[model samples]
Target chain A: MGTALKEKQEKDLQHEDLLHRYRNFSARRVLFIILGVLILFVLAAFSLTLGPADVTIAEAVNTLLGMPPSGTVDRIIWNIRVPRVLTAIVAGAGLAVTGAAMQSILRNPLGSPYTLGISQSAAFGAAFAVIILGAGTTQSTASDAVIFNNPYIISISAFIFSLITTGIILLFVRYKNASPATMLLTGVALGSLFTAGYTAMQYFASDVQLASIVFWTFGDVARASLWPEVVIMTLAVLLAFAYFFYKSWDYEVMDSGDESAKSLGVDVNRLRLHGMLLSSLVTALIISFVGIIGFVGLVVPHIVRRIIGGNERYLIPSSCIVGAILLLASDTVARTIISPIVLPVGILTSFLGAPLFIFLVIKGRDFW
Target chain B: MKLEIAGMDFAYDRKLVLKNVNLKVKEGEFLTIIGPNASGKTTLLKCINNILKPKKGTIKVDGNDINHIGMDGVARKIGYVPQMSNRAFPTTVFDTVLMGRRPHGNWKPSDSDYRLVSEYMEKLDLQDIALREIGELSGGQRQKVMIARALVQEPDILLLDEPTSSLDLKHQLEVMEMVDKQTENGLTVVMTMHDLNLALRFSEKIIMLRQGKIFAYGGAEVLDPVNIEKVFGVKVSMAHGSCGPVIVPESCVI
Candidate 1:
């Protein structure tokens, strides 16, 4: 009778333990999600407040809320600063989420937009548009002369090339049964090849064309107008995010290796191809608009993994929000740190992202 | 469900791995295949799950040719576990097990799926470490988690390739015992094992392979001392123990 009572008590304890765990897990996830959304709002507000013509946080809020604004502040807040800030936030979130998805799919921490040669290929394509297509030159007259002044054409070219590069890499890796190390090496080689082509274009470019190419590569959110480019990029990012979120479970399974995922009823090849395409599409859209922002893709996913573990359900969304905040903060610093002279946000990201990545590496060395 | 393979011939490029192999597994039977290294044990297991298509011959599960069924449909009927454990990403134990329900439902796990996963975790005594990262677990714990994941699939057929290769002796017996118990539930289990004695002790039937062809297929009675010596190229003596007959390799006397 004593043994039966002991067993009953143990069963009750186990039941309570499970209940506690389920409640705690759900609660913690909810808390993080709320925190993430709140951080995005705060960062958005901060971004709106910074720029060449500084508006006070209060005025910016009133302008955003469609209240009466004082003097030139309305134009500065509405026309220029708002679009730039929104561009930074959207592009940052999209790129970081893409990076996270890529890393999870490839099962490599180093996998990213730039590391996988997608961004570099896009940059090369843009450079090709500028040089070969003469899109950078300002034309004055002559009906027969080709005019490549539109940024959309260049962006489309970049997107196409980036997709092609990713497809080629996937085909080669699948055929060769290449190890992750070899995949990374191949990506690096492809990146270098594209970079070389871009450099050659730069060498042949005129002074004005060179300046334009350099600025594009340095990444500027300022070029984002309220045009079709913004609309298209926004739509593309949203679609990519939706697709990735839907496949988050598959991505999580994939991190366990291909064989395991296959046995668990995941079509490993289809999952991988879909993930790569989504990631490449997101990366291409961001790079086309903002040019080559280097380290956000490499660093943000690692940070998100450390914070919430590598479950894609949490990782994808968390990385998106944290990435938006980090880039917004970096952009704000870039604009305000030197007052009138704004440094490129990409440069600032590298300066900040590198140290943060190193810190995470040191802290999470045991897990790695 | 019964699995039948008829005149199966498979090869990588021109080098044949399995040639004209025929086998049948009844429902609720524990079948183990034992062979020397490079005897195509892993390859045969891969073919059963349609991971590698047989160059010649057909495989059927429950009278339906596997090729006629879609890959996902075939996967739903069979659960496979490979020999190696190399998870590059640090996913948690619960999520790993939850993945087995992939073929059963949509992308998001339903409540029933979670319940099934929890049941398996508890059965495997893995509830304590369900929240932990898979990488942090010991070899035995990791193997248990993999087995738990496969169990969550609720597959009619479970195929394992050297499932106990990395496990310690105790964990090996623990795993085999679990597999043995599952047989009573009318689930067919096919496994490739490296340990001859364990295979003999636990499996209801054993298939011995040499050069990708079946050398022998029968109960422990057919696995005589002469046959063991011939297949493994090692001298062994059989003794009747308390539980059953034990094959002790002569080299172990030292």
Candidate 2:
């Protein structure tokens, strides 16, 4: 009876120990989440305050909250800064989340929108839309002249091609039993091919058209308008994020390989296909609006993975938040660093992202 | 539940891996398929689990044909544990085991699923490492965790491919012993083992394969020195031990 009681007491202690560990883990994740959300909010406000025409923080806040503000302050904050900042947040989050999902699905750390050639494909499509479709005088001078002039259509075209290229790559990988290295090489080849095509189109383009394409590809949040393109991209990204969150566990299991996932009753092929498709969709949506921003998708997921373990539940959401903050910070730097002439958000991100990625690689030499 | 594979033939491209392989595993039987490398042991196992679609065959679980049932249904009834543990991401033992409940689970794991996982983990002596990352564990512990994951499926039939290949002697014995215990509890086990002695000791019946064909299929008593030498092309002697016959290679003798 004494031994039985001792055993029961030991069991209770073990149970308590498990509970404590679980609570601690959950607390850490929740704290990070809260911290991430708070940081994003702070960054958003900072973004609103930091432009060429500096509106006071109070006026910016008032304009944001839709109060009756001074016309100049209202116009500067509402018309100029708000949309750009929101674009950065949305595009950053979307690209990062998409990258996280792609990396997990492909089981390749190097997997991302740009790494998989999705961005390049989008660029090709955008180039086609601008150089080929927009070049026709009839369409260029029509009532929808502004539509042809807008970069959004080109972005959408690029997005569709990116999705197509991604689909083709997946099919090839599946059919040929290609290694991850092979898939990476294939993506690079496709990306380079599309880039070549885009360059040729640029060579033939009018000065204004070439400049527009260049600006679009280089990425400028300042060019982002509070238009239907922004709204659609935002909705698509949010929906994708929600769907990924719902299926995060399935995505985690899928990283274990097809046979293992299948034995565990996950439709491995379907899961992978769905994940890739959704990721590409989100990538296309964002790249369509903001052109191709690099590194956030590539680096954000890796950073989140290091902090929280590779459970997609934590990884996806954290990546979204981190991506948003990183882009906002980078965009701020781009605005301030050169003063009057703003550096492309893409260039700034790559500049910051590449160095940080190299640091991470150096630090995480032993990490899998 | 009984598993029946009738006239199963499998091929990769045009090269046949299995030809007219008919196998019937009775309920609660511990069946081990022993074969040399490239003898189709793994292929046969894959066909049984429906991972590789057999060119010409029908697999039936209990009374229902697998073709009629969905892959998910087949998976619910059959659990597979591969030879190696290749995890791209660092998954915890608890989460890995919880994945076995995927077929029965919604998006989120339920209370009963957690309970079942815990029970299986406890049974496999994996409770200590339940929260630990799978990559941190040793080969044997990872294997046990894999087994626990399979168990959480509540499968009637467990299929293991070279389950003990990477394990040390102690772990190999421990894992096989667990398999032995599982059989007594009415869990049907089908496995492929490279070690003949381990197969002799643990399996209720052994099915020996050579070049995609069954060389012999019977009790351990029939797997004598002459047969072992003939099948494996190695000289060996079988001596009666306390519990069973012990196979000793000729090189072991002074």
Candidate 3:
């Protein structure tokens, strides 16, 4: 009896310790999210002042805080930098949240808008607009920017083709009863087909058309105008984010497996369909305006997952913050790396994201 | 919950998986389904949990048809732990177990949900590794996590598929004893297992299935050499062990 009492006391103490540690882990996740938001704020401020206009961080912040536009500095801060940074933040958050959702719904760590061919389809659509419909032309300006004949046509066509690819994949999932792995493979196959179409379009293009198509393929957040494009993306991204956040528990249950998720009262097929449609819609919207910013969707969620584990309540929000930070920082570097000759932020993200992803895979094999 | 299945049939495409299965389990009864490979033990459990829709059947819980209860209603009554697989993500053990409260609550878990999860984690001896990733645990630890997840659901009926398949002797005994205690509290347990001895020790009622059909169903005496040979195609003799009676496989009946 004495031994039993002693054993019970020991077990109670152990339980207390376990509870403390669990709380600490939860606290740590919250801390990471807080820190991420702070970093995003600081980075956004720094990014606003780092362009060719020589505006200081204070000046940019002042302009953002309702300072009257008195000179070139205020105009550049309000017009160019604000729209670009806001676009990056919204677009980045959308890609990351959708990436996290895609991974959960598909039960594949490699699942993302980019990996599932939404970006490629968008690219194909843009190519069709530029090469076939003559929607873009190369303006022989000092900046060598490709001016769209009707930018809305390019964006609309890109959006349409992306939906078409998503439609084909959903059809396969519905009729063929395709598994997540099978769906990914289908995405890869369709991605290749679309790439072939894009290449064929390029082969038959005029020099100006080819230049315009190539330039449009280079994803740049600065391409978005503030009036409708940025406003539309912001609303779409926030709506999708809210939906994903609300369905956070369901996504966490889905990580267990489809059969297990069903047993837990999740309608696995419906969630998958909804998740894919919303994620693809948001991806198409972002890509249509800013072109194919590849790696934010794929890599940011993974980095956040490694830190916070696979709990979607924390993972989704953390991925959003980290996604915003990564894209914003990449955009800043793309514009400032060789001043007056801004590289495409999409090219820079892939350049940075590829190596970082490889390193994470090598170093954290147990993360998945 | 009292469960009744009548005229149950399940098929994958044209290939039949379960054929005209019928069963009635009383509330708080400890039932074990024993069978060979492809014997539909797992399928029957899935059907009961409403994870798979049967081609033709009516499953009732407390005389109410499960089909009419809706998925969430069924999940509130039945908790399932599937067979352990290699597919795992980096979810913490505590968070994984807390997911069992999904049907009971809304989006966020309530405080009582956390309390229940903590209680089950302590009972399962998983509190020590509560913060560890599920993927990082050994097979036995992962199995315990799975069991704890199911137990935290607070369901009237618990379904387990090969719960002890990966556990060692000590863990096997511990899990069985824990589950046996739950049965005393009026939790109905329906488990499919390959281990005949463990089933005999803990199961008050035994179901022997062979090729998608019930070969035998009764008390411990029903698991005799004749029934075992017919269902499992193995010749076995019941012998006394230090703890209880054990089935010693003598030779292959084929």
Candidate 4:
């Protein structure tokens, strides 16, 4: 009896020892996250000075610090350049983090923001709005809505359609088989379906409506922001990131497969559904504003995973910073490379992203 | 810490997998459930762990019906390691094991979670490869990593399905030894094993399952030639080995 009592006491002490062990995490991970933040700020600052109006870093900072505007330079920096940069950063981050979550939720590496027809649906909505509203109304509503020509109507239309598109996917999740493959296939079918609808709508668009539709599809950050309008998405994506970060460990457990995760006490179905809705919402918000920027959502998550491990707590923020910096850099190049002839940032991303991704894959050699 | 099941029925898409199954597993008991393919061994384990909801049944841990306590609560008491997981994409071994602490935490891992994970990793001889991706590890190493992840749950009962199915002979024995050690402590283990000999050797109790029902269950005595023939439709003779009972299959008489 005495021996058994002592043995049990020793076991309890061992359990107590585990609880008492002081906790500290790796310093290297912290350094990388801090480094990513610094790189984003540096890249954004460098990008701000590189556009058609060559505002120097000092001028940009002075204009930012609320000093008296140096006439056109201040106006250009504050109005055109600043909003464009902020929009690019927020939209890029939203796309990448949401893409990461979507891939995990679907349990498919190929899953992305565009996977569920979100971009096509948003485009269809924008085009549909242009065809209907422009023919019916005068030119006054166009400028009033558009950033330059017809902005607000197209965005609002895109936003509404994108939500509807995500709604379709969620409906499939609830009623039909909610498997990852089913979702991916459904997304592909929806993408084709929406593209066909947009093409049909385009046939009836007038000259002015057609041009606006074409411009929206080019996916430029220049068209998105005026002043504080971009704040909505920035705040929304931040809230989404915080929510996912709070449940980051659950995502990690989910990587082992649904059954294993369920046995670990995770509600696998609910979390996957939650993740899909959230990812769709994030993508829809960006697509409505930025017009279907491709590859950032799909590419940035993998790049972040390559640098950092597959932990969402770090991966989500890191992907955000990396996506922002890369898109900002891409946007900077798109505007500056031809001096006055600005290229769409979307074209530049594919041009730069593919070769670099191929190089990483080849150099990775043993990591498969 | 004891697992008890009564009048359990399970079906996938209304195709019954396990029917009218009743079982009781004691604390610190090593119970090996053996059955042929689709015979419902895996389903039984899943039902106990709440991975699958029974059609009509009461599964209790320490006399508490598991359905009432909820899955997260069941998770604190039961940990399950799947038979195969090649579908899982790459993540570091440490991160993979740390995921077991999810039931106990939501945001960040507690100090105790880390310490328990470290201890299990050390016990499983996985400290050397903790930073390596699970995809990079060999089959045997990955199995150990999975077991380490299951152990971090600090579960009173551990359930495994075909854990050593793909492992080599030496690796299989090594993996079994690690699981057997869990029973020496206060943890109860219920595992579905492919090798009848491994089951007979390691398990204190063996349950023979056939057609979604308990054909027979108990100690090594219940695992005799006649019962084995009835359950598996094979001719087998049992002999005393240096360690435990050894089963030799003479013919597939079915």
Candidate 5:
């Protein structure tokens, strides 16, 4: 009877432990997502006020909501600042989430939409359109968000060509069941191959075309101010993000390695295929609008993983938030730092991201 | 559950690894596979777990072909702990073990699974470092974590490939003894190991493989010095120790 009493008490303690663990796990992740969403919104609101025209944050918010901000503030807020900032948030969020998925599927920390040369190939296609086929030039710009002069044709070509790179990579992965190193090497090799083709095309381009091509490759988020393109990017990113959430649990297990995941009954090849397809789709969507925005996809996920340990459930959403904040804040600085000069958003990300990436490698040397 | 393998064949790059391997494992039996480097022990285990599909054969669990069953169903019945886990990321020990519950269709780890996993973690003495990174743990600790993970699956059959390869002698005996105790409840145990003495002491049955075929299969009587020398090209003697027949490897012939 004494033993029976002890067993019953032990059962009660075990039950309590289970409930406590579940509560602790879920509460932390929920708080993280809530905080991320909050930060992204605040960053988006403030970024809208940062430009040569000098609209204050409150004025920008008021103008956004159809209130009074004096004359033509609504037009500038509606036409210019709102779309640009929104695009930056969308692009940044998309790239980072895709980065998280890429890293998991490839089992490599450095995996990203850009790492697999999707962005480089997209740059080649967009450059091809600008230089060879005679596209947009920034010589006659009144408003600074002005790189997307030939929007329709350029966007389509970039989207199509990015998918082409994704297809090649997928085909390669299917054949050898490629390792992470192989994927990285193949991607880098593919990038060089496309770079060679793009360089040859540049030689035939005239001086005006060459200037436009240079602007496009530097990742101008300004190009996305065309409302229809912004609408497409925003809609697509959100939808793809939803899909990633559904696949997050599978990704968490896959991080252990393919054999372990298979032992756990996960169809590893299918999961990787889904991850690659969705990530590339998100990459194609963003790269089409903004030319090769490097490092956000590669960098933001690493930072998020370091902060909160690598559970894909929290990792995916937190990465999106951190990425959105990073891009929106950087794009704002890029616009206002030199006043009317307006450095490309891509240039700003590399300047910030490269040094930070190097520091992380040095500090957390054996992170993987 | 009863496991039967009939005419199982496997090849990698046109070189056959396992050929016509036939075996039957009854419920609650401890079976240890002993073989040299190129023998088909690992391939046979992989076939049973459905990691690699044999060229032509059937692995039936209680008379149902493993191919007919979904991989999840196969995973539900058999918990596999492979040799030398290549884990790079530092996930928590609890998270590592909790993945075993994934195949059982419980998304949040049902109360029972949590209870069972906790029990196994405690039994394995892994509760102290349950929240620590798997990568941070010593090899013996990680091996225990792997055992806890496999145990948490609550599988009818537990398949291990060199489960004690990294463990020291003390932990090795502890794990094998624990597995031995669990088999009293009709849990099927199949594992491959290099230590024939442990197999002689702990396992109910042993299967010896040479090249791509089963050379011998039976009780400890099959591990005679002649058979050991023929299979492994090593000279060894079996002595009647206090525990059981202990295999003493004298020297390698090759």
Candidate 6:
């Protein structure tokens, strides 16, 4: 009789220990994601309505749905505003997700495409195409105005050079089995090397060539065409996001440390290599097309992390939506804030993101 | 599971860390390794779990060579808890403990996984801080969290490196008692220790290492004053406490 009572007590204890649900998956995170998507929708709609020639949201939606208020409104909405908004959404989402993945794989908070020197390498490639390959020619209208003879040549060159940097880093990881710190150090060294190469190209270029180089360096979303470029960016960003979300659990295991991660059956080396390769490819694709947008990649993931905590399942998707929100919002303000004299969205993002990142570091709760 | 290490040698760039080491641990035995600094205690533990490749020789679990077993298979049999360090990313306590279920399932934890994690968290008194970031927890709390993580893996052999370091007296007793209870339930535990008294009190068997070699290996009687002086270059005495025999360091060996 005593043993039967003891067994019943033991069963009761086990039942008491079972939780209703894991705390990591909370209502707050899902609500935050839904709210983020809503904000992105509003931002995209609002942005389409802003610009030099105003179009109301109804007209924008009408044009987007294949009926137009007028031909000129169709041109403005289809040719100008649609591509710009779509580019911002895809480019912003891609870069921010890549940044989060890079930070996790490299195990460094400062890890991003910009910090890892992929952007500098692309800039060097663009300069090489402009000055050496004669991809840009001066337009007859103005002394400083240069037009691209073939924009594809410049983009292909930039993409190739960025891959070269990625190749060198991967070789180190494969052969030397370099640690994350060592890999990040190699990136810093390569960044400086490419920066020097860019300066050297600028020193010998003609005035028109130099102007073209500077123009290509400014990150502008309108440079892309509507048909293939935006479509390709969308495909790549979705693939990358899906891959990251699928691997979210492995990334969470990795947050403990490499040794602990390995002990838990994660192939740390393989994951690091694949993560770096995919992130670098996505960053190169965006930079080669839109030039170099700064700070969005580095800052959006951090903001989401602060709000929802660092479970990657929620963090990856939230960063994608929030990234679109940040970049689209920045582009809207850039174009509308100065009237007809539109500033490059890169400049505006830096101006805003730098102070916001600083505020987070100084005043927010300690995330790391 | 029984663990057998035979003729193992490990070196780092021509400097030997573990040399010609061989030992055996029976199933359900609690074995503690006590050694001084740089004595290869951690290295031997790592080799048993295949974290480090040995220069020569084999480590077998349940008579099957662990080297032949794939990482997933090895992880199923052996759960390793590394020494505690501050994590850079902010992960919640529940998630960290839940990660032990990785080898058993995919990215999404099943209902059983959550239930197991909850059980161990409750056992370790970690349910109150389930949502707190791991970085914010005190050292003792973090150690318990790590131990809880290993427990949820449900491995037959558990390897720990300095599991009680930096903990207070009460915490140290609590951690040791938790592990002791598991060993009573047919879990094989191997850990490294700096405190000889705790090792003597709880370790069913003990291995004392010196200069990358096993100086002594036997039951708890191996933790004598002379062996302590020889291994650590410290003179010591034995005293009895409420728990069991306790080693007291008297002075450094001249």
Task: Specify the highest-DockQ model's number.
Answer: 6
Q: Clashing residue pairs, candidate 5?
A: none
Tell me chain A's TM-score in each of the predictions. Answer: 0.88, 0.88, 0.93, 0.86, 0.89, 0.91
Better of 3 and 4 by DockQ: 3
Native-interface RMSD of candidate 5: 2.2
- Misplaced by over 4 Å in model 3 are A1-16, A69-72, A355-368, B86-88
In candidate 2, list every pair of residues with a backbone clash.
Answer: A122-A158
* Per-residue accuracy of model 3 over B155-190 as CA lDDT, tens digit each: 899999989988899989888898889998999999
Instruction: Evaluate model 3: give its TM-score.
Output: 0.96
- Could you report the DockQ of all the candidates, in the order they appear? 0.56, 0.54, 0.64, 0.49, 0.52, 0.64
TM-scores vs. true structure, each candidate: 0.92, 0.90, 0.96, 0.92, 0.94, 0.94
Q: What TM-score, to 2 decimal places, does chain A of model 2 have?
A: 0.88
Model 2 over residues B60-164: C-alpha lDDT tens digits? 999788777777788788999998768777767877888898877768778678667766776787777876787888889999988888878888999999889
Q: Write candidate 6's Cα lDDT for B1-254 as tens digits.
A: 39999999999879999989998989999999999999999999988988888999989999999878888778888999898655657988988898899988877899789888877887788888887888888889999999999889999999999999989999999999999999988899999999998899899999999999999999999999889989999999988888788888899978
Write one digit per residue (lDDT tens) for candidate 1, span A83-189.
Answer: 77778778888888898887876678889977788878988988888877767666533321223387777777787778778877787667876555666677788
Writing each residue's lDDT as its tens digit, candidate 6 over A1-368 gives 99999987885565454453444356778999999999998889888999778799999988889999999999998887888899999999999999999999888888888678899999999999998899976673342234677788899899898988888998999999998898898888998999999999999999888988888888877666475899989998998999999999988888778888878888888899998899899999999998889888888889878778888888899989988887888888887886676667788877877777788778775776
For residues A284-363, what per-residue lDDT tens digits would candidate 5 score against the true structure?
Answer: 88988888888899888887766567778778889888888888877988988887778888888878777776786676
**1 or 6: which has the higher lDDT?**
6
TM-score of 5: 0.94
Ten-residue stretch with the least lDDT total in model 4 chain A = A135-144
**Candidate 4 lDDT by residue in tens digits, A77-181:** 878888989998988888888888888888877888678888899999888777876522334243223333466777888989888878988988888856988
* Candidate 1: regions farther than 4 A off: A1-16, A70-74, A137-150, A170-185, A225-227, A364-366, B251-254
In terms of TM-score, which candidate is stronger, 3 or 4?
A: 3
Number of colliding residue pairs in each model: 0, 1, 0, 3, 0, 0
Report the TM-score measured on chain A for model 5. Answer: 0.89
